[model samples]
Target chain A: MESNRRKFLKVAGISALGIAGAKPVLNAFASEQEEEAQHADVEIRKNEKALTARQWAMVIDTRKLQSEEDLKPIIEACHKTHNVPDVMDTENAEYDEDNQRHVIKWIWEEEYKHAFPTKSTEFLDDRLKNLPFLVLCNHCENPPCVRVCPTKATFKREDGIVLMDFHRCIGCRFCMAACPYGSRSFNFRDPREFIKDEDRNPEFPTRMKGVVEKCNFCAERLAVGKQPACVEASNGAIAFGDLYDPESEVRQLLKSNYTIRRKQGLGTGPAIYYIV
Target chain B: MLELTVKGSKKYFGWMALVLGVIGIGFCVYVWQLISGLQITGMSRDVSWGFYIAQLTFLVGVAASAVMLVIPHYLHNYKAFGRITILGEFLAIASVTMCLLFVIVDLGQPMRLFNVILHPTPGSVLFWDMVVLNGYLFLNLIIGWNVLEAERNQVPPPGWVKPLIYLSVPWAVSIHTVTAFLYCGLPGRGYWLTAILAPRFLSSAFAAGPSLLVLLCLLIRKISKFDPGKEQIQSLAKIITYAIILNVFFFFCELFVVFYSQIPEHMDHFKYLFTGLHGHGVLVPWMWASLGLMIFSIIMLVIPSVRKNETTLAIACIAVFAGTWIDKGMGMISGGFVPNPLHHVNEYVPTVPELVITIGVYGIGVLILTALFKMAISIKEEVAA
Candidate 1:
């Protein structure tokens, strides 16, 4: 990358000087450079499919989950351990009261409405309106969050989990806005305020104000062959397995059950599936 | 007559602008935000964009408003607009400059903005917004400068310049329409999902933007001895009246649709905007203020006796401009995100750094506007000679 950049700078400088001296020479050089850039893109594409890794995904069985009370503790433990700050008390509280303000650290989504107008529907009773599902970053085939981020702070890993580099983030929170699932959270205030001084999850870095922070599917833990904290804490109700490995536990579960994503209509093609 | 160029208009304006500059400087206290992250602003995860974007929306309207004069004078040959089109263009340049600055300030890493061009995402609305705004800015620069140069040189502008001038009439409309598209194109935000949003934005901008220009022209008349003519002023007031009525009518049409559909997803945004859904009521007063100002301004502008009366027209302009700014600028952006998709409220308030950055940008715009207007006045003085 450095050598290419250096070569580009040298080429640009030489071309600029050439343009000042001879316009025809500069035009020839520019066209040649453009052709080379196009060829490089084609070369990258030819080699892309050969690259492989353990494509990790999750399967949550919502039918096994009884109530918010049954799920809250496991959700809170991972959240508190991860230092995911609660966003309930901010100015947006006027729209909804505190505690009702949404904060996520690998948790369940009780009610989700699809983005497409035709797909959006309500039940006769408020309780029966929407099915509860586990919500987290989809690690999508084509992630909008990764695409919209100007800094490239949010990116997808080879393992299929979308990772966010917290330190490099300028904190414009465009990722939070782009995510259709409402899976991302912005650090409205320093997470350090809520974090216990001695206790911190080294696997999940506490975020600063202004930047977006979301579930990375515990990329740090995955590097060491450990499962995600939420998957481990779900009392085996959640299954974590390699999506590429047809023999993996998640694949077996998928084959046995009617699996669904939180919002399949959005076409995110989420890696995480749920057993209805 | 020579003294007019030598002496600046209202020696007090420099000081007044400077005071605004000083107050703007006070916004620096929030610079920790850029270092610490966006936590300094009263924004949370849910309400991702806040006051900065709202201000951008309003200012964009103000920026695009330059067309009202340019179109009438160049297209229809309204000589009444002959003297003041430069002022509108100058204001457009100033406001658009600020609009770009606001986008920068809103970025988490302002430095990484280059990556936008380096790795452009053609699919995203943001990428398109960048293209249109920068394109509009360059277009305005050429149009404004060429016209000014023509007036200065005492020549009918070059024939090639005519196409560019004609292109600007639609291009002016495109800038604000694209801005509206920035919101409307978002799939999830029910408030912006309506197809009417872009037209509504244009109508409100036409009303507020020209109203502001009319006020500025009156001020130029009072202090700078630059009378832009009463007929031109009254003509713009008539346009403002119609635009405001259209804007208000479109808003009601939206309200009617939201109620008629009875869709929870669609209704929630309107509920949050006007009635304060789930108890978020901060936007209620601002909405009322906007509605009240629009109605009052329309009444004042509709009556010829009042619209013709310079003082009444000035007040009407101020009311309409401020009202439209509140509705388009503040209420719309916040209302879209409040009670966010997850039913979460993340209220956005401008922090100190955000405010300072905002003020600094506004100051820079004002300085640019002042210089351009000063140059325009001198050129006019030279031409009349």
Candidate 2:
């Protein structure tokens, strides 16, 4: 009976040690499964509600932006609506007389060669070569700007729009360095000085001097059920939709066209797609 | 301790007055900067960071370099560096103070500086840099003060102080590594987006920091009764030689990968730095000057006779310090911005106000170093007597 008790005690001790060692392993596997479930939930919800998904993206039809004139309306709508400053008169004496240092832009136009530098080739058609492309913040899926921002001034919304809280920006401009798209603009001086009082949009607040500003994808308009000013002005030339939704308009446009993104090879997963 | 600085010669008082005058002018400019905004400076939207950030980068290396002395004296138990480690620690204190000031001045809204601490985001490298920099500053302050106080009292430092001294060894490395990450982790900057940036920063810091220390030691020998010893300086020179060699080798490794691969993004900044990309090569002359200084210094330092001579060593140290300053300070920060995201070249030049502010900041560093070194040297002289 004593011998039997000793054997039983040894078995119980070994079992306890085994269970103690396995607990952490089990907990790790359980947490991983929970994470997988959370991912699955996102996928399912994205399919169920296209517009309400957590990722927002845009597609620009470059074929439609055929001329400098074609690009003006969208650029004007964004700048005017956002109360972006016009710094044409501000000059840096060090630079050449023609070179202006104070020009600030949120969304602007660039030639195809500069816009799509990596994809440009000599074999490309002359017409496409001459065509100007409307460019703005890619609102990257993994934004370097957000990663580098010391103040949480610029942050990604749950729906994946990279939004800027102008009040919070300390204007360090680290975000500008981190941005691969050159999409951000800093106020070199008081933006209020350059912005005409008459031209100022009463709805949108003008930025103070020393803060960084950029395209926010019109989160205000999106919150109110209106499309972005550029999208509305483009008249179907630009598609604004949920990127995670397989059936969303952006996804449909991306599927139907041979679309390219600026510096996509850098693995930033830029949301702004260009349909050539 | 407070009386220690007051007990200096007429020359010392005149130097303090000069530094104070610069600080006074800088304060006025800073007030103007605060009122008018960053427009008073030369920075634009394209080239966002300029002289201020560059100085901050260089000075962080200067701050981290206290480790060279710290490691030898504390970790390796090298006794010759005993008197000199305090000099390095004091230099660190001054450099870090200037680094913090540079960041404050560079901020678009200096008032909102607390936002970084108030709303901490661990994901941001800037947040990490803030944490590490402040931590390092405090670490140096605590260790430097306690160690010097103990020496003044002719007693061993408290038991807790030892661990903190050792902690500073790795903490020193982290300060520069985190600073490098501020640039390296940026996805779009081809020049900064390298795995080797942290290592390169460390190698450069090791060289630049020790060189400055050696210079400071020589200056101290001339100005005061405290001698940092020839042996310590020689050992430091050797350290600088090895570190500079590694730094140059790492840079070449970077060049080889970028040029051999023939990647446009990788080659763009190098081409701009070396051979003016797209007809805009403002930095080419400066880059070549920096390279020449570094190579010449390396040649001088490699030879035993040149390394041993006090005058030649000082010249070599100056060369290394200047070369590394330009390389890490101006070139790295500015080069990363050139061939910007849109593949456009926009050159940066600091305006008068910017340069004045930079000088003022440096003046502040020098003043702090003078005061701290005054107390240290006074205590050391008393102990020796």
Question: Candidate 2 falls in which docking quality class?
Answer: medium
Interface RMSD of each: 4.1, 1.0
Candidate 1, residues B1-385: lDDT per residue as tens digits?
Answer: 2233345656746655794666457446435656665555655557778878888888888888888888889999988887888788778888888888788777766666665665566665666777878877877777777787788778877788788878878888888888887777555567777899998998999999889888877877776545777888888898898999899899889889989989666788777777887667787888889999999988888898998898999999999998998897788887888767666655655556666766677777876776677678767866877
The complex in candidate 2 yields a DockQ of 0.55
Error of 2 at B211 (Å): 1.1
Which TM-score value belongs to model 1?
A: 0.80
Worst 10-residue lDDT window for candidate 1 chain A reads: A43-52
- Candidate 2 lDDT, tens digit per residue, B129-190? 89888999999998998888889879998889999999999999999999999999887788
TM-score of candidate 1's chain B against its reference? 0.93
Report the TM-score measured on chain A for model 2: 0.77
Candidate 1 CAPRI-style tier = acceptable
Model 1 residue runs over 4 Å out of place are A1-57, A63-134, A140-143, A150-170, A188-209, A219-226, A241-248, A251-260, A263-271, B1-13, B16-20, B23-27, B158-160, B345-357
Q: How accurate is candidate 2 locally (lDDT)?
A: 0.88
* Regions of model 2 farther than 4 Å from truth: A1-53, A89-99
Candidate 1, A1-276: lDDT as tens digits: 965885698699879887797865567579879999899877443232232347778898876765675567667766866777655534565745433333434554555343223344554345324445457777877687777665567888877878887766665566676676777876655567656656666656677555677777766666566677787778888888888899899899988898867557556667888775
lDDT of 2 by residue, A1-276 (tens): 964885698689879999998886688679879999899867432332233556888999987888888889999999999998767645555543322566778899987778887877888899877888988999889888988888789998898888898888888888999898889988877889877888989999998988998898887777667789999999799999998889899999988899989999878788999998
The predictions' CA RMSDs to the true structure, in order, are 7.9, 11.3
